[model samples]
Target: MKFGTMFTDILASFFKKNSTQLYPFEKNPTPERFRGNLYYDPAKCTGCCLCVKDCPSKAIELVTIDRAAKRFVLKYHMDRCVYCGQCALNCRFKCMGMSNKDWEHAALNKEEFLVYYGKEEDVREMLENISKPPAESEHK
Candidate 1:
């Protein structure tokens, strides 16, 4: 009985196609509306902070660059993000969305998970300004 079962299994294997996919060589098509990674467009963003507020995981951080000028630096912590798509849905300006292209978020360092979405100059200036000591007048 065992010999007969083994022979049947061997015959079936010859007719059936391999179920495994060659992942590195052959990529599978991502489904429509696939929530993979967060994408932000600074040009479309209005500095409303709606997306930040709506995020359930508290992964979104809005750093104020120039409040009077309505400038902001949007910080997205991929490590903390739950990928719930709530931030994109809450965005009134349609600046934030999920992209299927950047699903791979593997990194050796924790800092690598932090993604900033804003003007390059603004981000640099904000970092510099934060590092500086406050004026004596402000302390007084």
Candidate 2:
């Protein structure tokens, strides 16, 4: 209301400790169970689809290239993920978890939100299949 009152308040705030964290410049430790980016381990995955089924957001999809060879690709839609950790909780093989460190997912492109977790060759194959037109894929 008064200039004197406002001046004292501003001075007090200047002397007081900062209550905000300096993110991007100064990093703070995340909690033990902090859920961030979605990660999938292809080696431990068995193509059971339990994680896929339990996800309420329908963010994860498991694609099986060869069930006999234990080859599978995990399509993780980061944008759709609710970060509820249901997929991690439902994975019996310990193939899925949320990364606390690599959680900075801010991006300008939508394609960056879609992540594929699997062997390099398998991911490439899956990407190729997705890029192909429906008519061409039907013939192959």
- The C-alpha RMSD of each candidate to the native structure, in angstroms, is 2.8, 2.7
TM-score, per-candidate, Cα-based: 0.80, 0.85
For all candidates in order, the CA lDDT equals: 0.85, 0.89
lDDT of 1 by residue, 17-71 (tens): 9898897687788877898889887777677788888888999998877767757
lDDT of 2 by residue, 1-140 (tens): 89999999999999999898788898888887899998888988889999989989899899999878878999889999999998998888998899887788799999999888999999899889989877745554
- Residue pairs of candidate 1 with colliding backbone atoms: none
The candidate that achieves the highest lDDT relative to the unseen native structure:
2
Off-target runs (Cα >4 Å) in candidate 1 are: 1-4, 7-15, 67-70, 133-140
Best candidate, TM-score: 2
